[model samples]
Target: MQRPAFDPTAEEVARRVLADIRKHGDKAVQKYTKEFNGINLPPAKFAVPREERLAASASMDLLFKRTASEIFARVVRFGKASMRKDWSMATPKGGVLGEKFTPLARVGAYIPGGAAPLASTALMSVALAKIAGVPEIVACTPCDKKGQVNPYLLHALEVAGATEVYRIGGIQAIGAMAYGTAHIGKVQKIVGPGGPYVTAAKKLVYGDVDLDMVAGPSEIAVLADETAVPAHIAADLISQLEHGTGHEKALFVTPYMSLANKVLAEMERQIASLSRCESITKAAASGALFVVTDNLDTGMEVINRFAPEHFEIMTKEPRRWLQKVKNAGAVFVGAWTPESAGDFVAGPSHVLPTGGTAAFFSGLTVDSFRKRSSVIAFTRADLIETLPLIEEMGRVEGLDGHARAARIRFENPS
Candidate 1:
């Protein structure tokens, strides 16, 4: 099936909103909040109150709190394991070359909350930044018409170590984080996923601050065979669609036509019971696709072309096929490992590359919150040994000063 066309208007809108925020700061943010989000919030009210965060935690269900804590622990464990370490190697001429990894001092995380409050997103982004030893993590999410964020979401942000919480979202939130307002401090980097407007804002603000990725709509591809459960396949497809955005893509590729038909039937049956059936129906009409291939090789070819954010292999030997997958933000092997596991507790951040960008861009990782710098220390002997090569290249490049600088050090021997 053909992919949906891009919307140029969204980009234009984001451009205008971002420019307005960059110039006017808090005033522009408040104006957009009233214009877009339909709420009148002053600069002082932009940041969520500390008492409200405490109240959310106090009112959260015990079971849900435990679950959130468990998910946070699992994500932290994965983040720590995946973190890169500083390393150095001795050179032959007694010089040392190495890379030093340092976490960004401050970062902003956007937790999507328009259609549904993505509480898990708080843990996914903030916990990883915390594990990377980031000093301050600011969180932003949209509030309801009542001017209150979801209790669960606020609790998650606090639990995940967000140093500050803001009740703003969309392009305005991205702008405020990128360019500091009187109410909000500028962050070194921005992480988390959002809808098209937020994605566009991130793109426009790329040079101003570092970004996690151009994460747009959610997408999933399922490669199944006779061994795959039709019900499970149907449920997974519907799950991706239920992200509440009609832009999500769900593709099913199978060699067995019979299994494909069964999964379709199962989807029709299961979607009827979903509370978000309207969203699922809209997404299915636009973004859902089913392709029946003659063999597994042809199916694999189709999967590579799409390069979905999440790829599920539910075949007899899922591992064997995994070796052939060159692109995908994340892969779920076997029937037991569902996409939901990776979304929630699988230890990897769900802020993955979308819009077929998995071919080049990678999902969010521990290193996303850190910066790496090459460290080089050269002795006089080392400089002398390399001077000829450097001087020759400098001269060839018409950089006489570069060659003279190296020559002066050797000539003076001071």
Candidate 2:
């Protein structure tokens, strides 16, 4: 397989797209959509009707309806458990300083609808917001050629407690959510992953509305040893590739070239039988690679440096080697714990940072849905105890008003 050293050009492209989104608004958005997505949405074309969204609730398969409900229930359970609450603690001097947690009043979630129907994403975002006590959750997605929202995606949003469903995509929807327009109300934060254009829009409107991390391509690193089965490693590599273009990378780092070749052969065999063979094949051939390391320690070092979105440790005594892993979006230990399991039914979030961003960013979690504020309270005793130090610091900093305020608190106790 052909591989190149890690590139930073992708980040540069993201910055340029953001500039375009800020300058031309929807006009620039539509042009890019047509050029890239091959879809032309005229002015006002992106808004999906409220009735259609409602009607979509009744149109999904019964099994999907039940599954969507279950997904929301799980997400809600996780989210509510971590919901923010305000708290204040008292000190001996009658001083109190604590923290308060609050949900953003409203949030906008973007669901990518170009190639796949991300029903799960809709459920995860909206249901988590609902559990966090967000007053409103607005969801947006691109429409199909027939001008209809994906039924399953709509159903998930409904189950997850979205207040409204908008049939807009690309920069226009992002702008509407960030800067309230006649058709769409503004939201406090905008989240979820999208194409380059939607991501650019989020970057452009960041100051106006908070955003999640700027996402990059998805990636996976497999730390396998001679004991690891080649077939399992191969299958996992293909699984990451199915996620779409610029969405996957597989690193096979081991001392044994024989084992790596075996895995590559297995990948080639499996790719031939899959329906998305061309994509998986090309992705595997290009994104997948084998690295010959001197030892497991060296392999672990390389994996840590990459900090892939998914890390699979396949070695004898996997648990022992697992402790060595310090970085990754999520670590799947042992042969039984496949990467695909983490993406869906494993109860952890599949929305992870990629392109080495996992070193700093975390996968979507309950923490994403809440914010905090510092809480402070002071009694007369507390004021008197700290007054001299506060006055001294304030005076040294030339903040006479601060010193006076502290002195006044001590002089005039409430």
Candidate 3:
């Protein structure tokens, strides 16, 4: 499949808007929010009130609320289990060496609500932050023309422990969080997957705030065999394609040309029933492909090179093929495991690296919500043992002061 061109225009627009928001404060945020999302929110009203969040939670159906609770429990349990713990090891010379993990003070999550409300994302992003003990979790999403955000999304955010929720989206929401406006305070880091515009805005503000990854539109790849169900493969492919970005990609790879043809036919039949059929059709035409490799081994090579956001292995032995994959945001093991399972109910956060960034970056986890600090407690013996090494490096770098500072401690014999 052809890699979509990174939007050059998006960067230009984001840069201008971020600068305007940085310099002009809330006024600039409101202007762009109205222009792009049609949400007419004032500075004070940018953040949804706590009463509204509570009401959203209350209004949800009892059965649906119970289902959401079950999913959230799994998400939180996984976060706690996966979180890295602080530990120390004794150094060679009676010194202490270790790492300490601490939760971030404040963070922002961008939930896409333009084409869909994405209630699942509320738990996917903010729930992990909550589990990581982030004191203030701020959420941003686009509101309707009347400035009303999705009630379901608001309810999910509330349940997931969002301390603040804002009715804003697009580059404006990113800009507001990255560079603090009068009302929305700047966050230490920003996370969650978004459309092309949000992705570009996050990139422009990299120095202004830390970001989870260069996450954008969704993409998927499937390494399947003749034994794989054509209907299952087709439905999984269309899932990522319906994310409303025409840039989304869904690659179907198989050694058997017959199986590939069947999956393609199934995609056509299944797409008409989807609400985002127009967007899915546009994505499939431009971004989808089927590669017939020489064998499954060669097919695995093609998959790793593509480095898709979500990868499914539907062969005789999915586990065996899973060992061969190198660059996917997440791997679904069998026909029973679909990408949607990971997005909605799986223990891990759905916010993942996209656009082949999985080659270097990993998906969001509890660790993403915390910062690590290297801990070093040096003994006198440790300082003396490593002093010569430090002196040699300092001498080579021509930093005499660095060496002298250490040498002076030993020079006086105290």
Candidate 4:
């Protein structure tokens, strides 16, 4: 299917799912899972035993296990270093006010188990949560038709330090994790990437629990010039297009028509031999666009407007252009740095904002897993100093109780 342009209507649907889940928890979850995923495992399929989780990892090929572990180690290291300490500040009013950052006590990390199991996502989601100091991290992925979570995903989850792993997917898994079913417990927040239904569920459950951005189909935009290599541009475009068969858009912009056409031709030639050509074709049909600009600045302006999820700058001064880039989930500098580098082993979180949301939303990071509480310390001296102003402000706001409280504190000087 042509990846539909970023859909606000999908958010509406997600809101409905959230309401339905609240009204009828498991029943709604099961109904949606059965209708959408074509699976009916009931709540029994939710939990993946500790033994099974270990077995899943053990079953992996030695090399795969080694490589995944190494990657996990790097991610863990990054997570630890990314941890933020508590902070405070002294106010001019002699009052102390500041904020302390604490990891949520419990968190839910959703890993999409689509046709291609996202073992990498397991690593990203769980490792980040672990580093944030979450005591209980529950993970959920949908089971395949044969009723098993992909063993690789289970292994990744195990390595990433998931306290609880469930073989559930789609809106139901979300509902279960958010609402606490007979089998699954509620979580403080849910994080991951999935199809529209999953996005919808996250939207639906936002107030009940924290959520990441409402992600859309994957996208990559390349800013290339005559000096840039066509093959490199083609490869990068294909790399992103190969992410899925549906509407994953790839754009190549250049100052000259010749280079743009050359890159477009290169894409046609290179795409034919790719394993995911058919998928890429569908994605390209909706996702791909050729943007020709009179100059590099014009291209940069257009790119900033798109604010792609993945942006590659194939220019003479790639490093300089990095500063010009104001909106992007992740920026791939130069031809050598492809989006896939960031997708797998790059230190930054791959769970990024999509659908022009890079304008405001940020990619997943340690901050996403933590919450902040403002701390205010008012000494007797401070309270007495600010009392009149506080009382006047409260009175003007029509809060008699607030004004009285402030008045009492100053009047008694206790």
lDDT winner: 1
**Ten-residue region with minimum lDDT total, candidate 4:** 1-10
- Pairs that collide in candidate 1 are none
Over 198-260, each residue of candidate 3 has an lDDT whose tens digit, in order, gives 999998888889999978999999999988999999999999999887888889899999998
Please give the distance, in angstroms, between residue 81's alpha carbon in candidate 4 and its true position after superposition: 3.3
Which pairs of residues have clashing backbones in candidate 4?
A: 14-200, 141-168, 142-168, 142-169, 245-279, 249-287
TM-scores, one per candidate: 0.97, 0.88, 0.97, 0.92
User: Could you tell me how far off, in angstroms, the CA of residue 308 lies in candidate 2 after the best superposition?
Assistant: 1.2
Candidate 4 stretches with Cα past 4 Å from truth are 1-24, 93-95, 412-414
Per-residue CA lDDT of candidate 2, range 178-241, in tens? 8776557788988887655565566668899987765544568898888899999999888888
**Candidate 3 wrongly placed segments (more than 4 Å):** 2-5
Candidate 4 has an lDDT of: 0.81
Report RMSD (Å) for each prediction in the order shown: 1.4, 3.3, 1.4, 2.6
Give the Cα-based TM-score of candidate 2 against the true structure: 0.88
Q: Residue-wise lDDT of candidate 4 within 2-25, one digit each (tens)?
A: 234345676676666666866787
Residue ranges of candidate 1 with Cα displaced over 4 Å: 1-6
True-vs-predicted CA distance for residue 59, candidate 4, Å: 1.4
Model 1 per-residue lDDT tens digits across residues 1-414: 435323467789999999899999999999999998999998999989889999999999999999999999999988888888999998779999999999999999999998888989999999999999999999999987678999999999989999999999999999999999999999999988888888888888998999988788899999999999999999998889998778899999999999999999999999999999888999998889999999888899999989899999999999999999987999999999989999988889999988887888899988999999999999888889999988999989999899988889867465
